[model samples]
Target: MASNRPAPEAPFIPAQRETETFGYGDHRTDEGPWEEWNPTEDSVRPVRGRHRVAKQRGGLARSSTVLGVGVIAAVGAGGMASAHTGKPPVSLSMPDLPSVGSLFDDSSASDAARATTPTLSKVGVTSADSDRSGNAGEALRNRIMAQAEQQQSKADSKATAAALADAEKQSAAAAAKAQKEAAAKAAAAKEKAEAAAKKKAEEERLAALAKEYKLPVVSYTITGTFGQPGSMWSSGYHTGLDFAAPTGTLIKAIHSGTITQAGWAGAYGYRTVLTLDDGTELWFCHQSSIGVSVGQKVSTGDVIGRVGATGNVTGPHLHLEVHPNGQATGIDPAPWLRDKGLNP
Candidate 1:
């Protein structure tokens, strides 16, 4: 290392006197006026103000002190350079005596040489600072990338969750729809089964009634149904079921009944009324002749009268009417006969 302390000044030495004169011999005249003398600071004449030594150029005066300091700095810097560069330090030596002109030369040459030299410590500091800067930049980039990835992951998770929710909703709706359709089908099937059961029960009842009743006339064609509308009838509608047959078709009792009346009616000629055990009156009109008398009890299938086309009639047919409980107003006889197992 170089010290910052100032360099020591060089010692002053007086110029040496010539021992012998140039043209004179070694011996001197004893009687001459010359004397033996030595030069001293006070004895020499001083230069005047304008005659003083001029100041040197290029930063500092040319002197042994400045030269010494520059040499010390150069040696220290060279040694450090050698250590860092893996090279051997160059040896530097000083001469025992040097020329005065060499020591007093311009200092500009030395400054230019020092300025061009490179220092190991300065380069090392710069390299270390650059490494630190690069590392900091890399760290910042990594943090930014991590944040971006986190955000993307969150977005993907949200999208997936939304899709799953939608799918669940659709699935639930489909399940509900299927359940409703199945329930509807079950109800319709139940209704159809109930209707079939009702029809079966009705057929069974009719079958049982068929064994207890008989039709009034055999081999007869139904010509007019009850409630047939026409101008020919006085009531504006036919009041009885008309059975067309030959003039002498035999009429039989529909059920076990008593003959209540056997006489001629105005519009229904030769009408015969048979009263059942329940007071239901059955009238057999347009009869050619009455076979059973009033107040006579007859069983089913017993002969009652003969079918004929009588009063207010255009053909040979038997008109049958029914009155519940002997009411004067008659009801349609077709359904009444069906109740007794007869499809008239």
Candidate 2:
């Protein structure tokens, strides 16, 4: 709190002031007449209210005066040094004064106040500035971590997609390969089935032919077939089928035909020429004996002659030849017999 009381007057008079006589007992000197003075509350004008200073005891008055003088001198020196060096002046904050009770009582309150006061260490930095810098660094670190995680996620996704695509391609290729294999197997199966069906049809045709015609010689071994290459035959190759059997094996007519010629024919001894109604001729050569005359009508399976080795032959066998349409040349009699449903 503030006080309205005036400051106390100085006890000593100023040298510049003119000498004056006081009502107390006076003494005269060359300079002036002075009176012995003692200050009391009435003369000093005591301070009023909360702003009043307590009376100093012991050596406290001298100590307080010295401390105040030292503080003022230090502050003035620091300000002058800053000005001379062309540097900014540092701000000094004074600690709050102790309460009146502390000054009047013990020094414990003053010591406590000094301990709690804040002290500045750096010129321009404060606790709040440091806190802001720490916050910024933490934010930057967090952002870097987040970016790393995001990049890793993207890489993982790409890898997964690539793997999936590769798997799909492999699956597609496998399916295509299977399909191709299946088609090849189907084609092979179809070809096999067609071949089997054709063979069966040929067998059925031969069976039907067997019912209509008979073989020329029964219980006989086919010693020679037509078109066999051998020097023993008169032509370059054999021209007829030879059925070997014992001499006098009954020779029968192969089909219903007329005996066009029945006589010995030179090289084809004791031959008989049977002419079919369609002019196809069958020659039965190397006969032991002829049973039919020329111009005779013979039915199928009739006795025609006997087996012989009368001609140019190595054994007893019947040699049969066929000529289509009375041509001089002959065809393979095996095929002709097959045409008449015989397997000779």
Candidate 3:
């Protein structure tokens, strides 16, 4: 019926159908009136177009992964730059495809330049540290020297004290010795003075005694002694000492005494007797003349009589006799007079 309308277009379909993709192989085995199907030149045109489209999609996905890794490296480089410059991290971004080569190349050149350059310190203190160390050493030396000086001073002080003590001891000993010597000298001088005083006293006593006593007669010759035998007396021995002298020789009294008898006796003619305070009687027999009276007091060296041969005598002489207690017997008058401090 020759419809006057345009024909409908065919719906588009993919060249690789779903059924064809799921099948295991492209070759089929069936008894049919068909030859082995081979790819035609016209049929290969669609397959080439599909392969090109797949290659484009795969390349776009791999490029996106590479861009993400590049963005991470850019962020790390920015953090490192912030640390070195002491600033905040710069905002990081993925570089445009056209500018990636130029941006990464410039960042590498800056890192190499930083590695070559040397850093400098702004506030310098090297000289100050050196000076401080030297001062510390000097201080230590000074302290050591001070300690040594203190020890030496202590030793010197001890030595001085010892020397002073020794000197004091010596001085004390010397003083003691001097005192002892002085005492000895004083004692010797006192002893000498005592001896001199004793000698002087003895001389004074002797001088006084010499003035108190005297001898009985000046000079006389002894002829007949007491106890002489030769028919000289009636008693068969001479009874007294005979002082032979010239007639009228002065006869002195021997000591202070009283006259008891002044008369002539029988054999002793013109005799005189003198009695002392102690009752001793001195008889003067053979006297030429008698001058003292009876009961008369006479002193020593006084004239008592004159020497002569008046009694029964041979020649002129003075016969002296000593009788204790006025007894008839008598002792030698020479020793009796000598006992009274008279050497006669």
Candidate 4:
């Protein structure tokens, strides 16, 4: 009957099918005749004898695991970026796929680039620790150099001090030697001057003695010499030398002379006088006998009289007197005899 009822609906049944994904050699099952086939639980399966399960109720477990991993990676990247001062990361995803974190890359380096980084020691300084290490090494080097310089300076100073001391020593020695030589020279010169003065004095004395008159006294025993002090004389000293002898001793002329007087005089008894060529006079008193008379010439060794007791005498003596220029003056008989190379 073309009844007004709607066309009958086909009987409905769900095919026994399992959704799956394929990877590598894994694929879905395609078996039996496709035209007449009805899919049954026994008819369909994975080709690798595997089929997808419910995917843990819409794959929530896997999705949760992936989401957790991404969150951790993003946190790590954010922390690194904070320290590095680089750009922020972005998330990339394929169509109908889960997203993944893509971190920013350093611009200075590429995927193929390699770097040769320097060590902190060679880089001189970077962090606080490296800066301290570098500074310590530099300070040590500078101290070593300074110590070396100081040692060298000290050595130089010592050498200069030694040189100065040596120079001073040499100069002192030279000056001492010069002074010694000068002293020796002065001594020699003084000795030479003294010798010359003595020689001149001796020559003058000899000349005066040669120009003097000869002795006038005759041979007699000399009792008193010239320059003898006498209390009986009017002068302080005796002017004539006294000769005490026997009354008969020969009286000889002391030098070449001429008889001046032979007579008795007051205070001079029995006197014989002689005169020299230089006007010198010799008196021989107390003569026992007068051999030569007045105005008689006599040589130096001629007999003039004999010894006798003269005036103002205690015994027989020939009083011999010498006078320069017959002036009633007398000189020393010792010196007069020494001038003729004879000792009185």
Weakest ten-residue segment in model 3 by summed lDDT:
27-36
TM-scores across all candidates?
0.55, 0.50, 0.40, 0.40
Residue 328 in candidate 2, Cα distance off native in Å: 6.3
Best by TM-score: 1
lDDT of 2 by residue, 134-252 (tens): 77678889999999999999999999999999999999999999999999999999999998998788778767656546788888999998899998778878888999999999999
Which segments of model 3 are wrong by more than 4 Å? 1-216
Q: What are the lDDT scores of the predictions, listed in order?
A: 0.73, 0.74, 0.66, 0.62
Model 2 poorest ten-residue lDDT run: 27-36
Q: Can you write out model 3's per-residue Cα lDDT over 1-344, one digit (the tens) per residue?
A: 33222222223332333344111244222111122223344433443222221222223333444445655655566566557646555444321133222222347764665454332221122354446547867887999999999999999999999999999999999999999999988888888888888877756754553354344345688899889987758999999888888888888887788999998887887898989888999888888999999999998778888887886989988888999999989998777765554556
lDDT (Cα) of model 3: 0.66
Q: What C-alpha lDDT, on a 0 to 100 scale, does residue 90 get in candidate 3?
A: 43
- Candidate 4 residues 44-67, lDDT tens each? 443343344322223334444544
lDDT of each residue in 167-231, candidate 1, tens digit only: 99999999999999999999999999999998888888888777668999879899998889999
> Which ranges in model 1 have alpha carbons more than 4 Å from their true place?
1-133, 229-232, 255-261, 275-280, 291-303, 324-331, 335-341
Give RMSD (Å) of candidate 2 vs. truth: 18.5
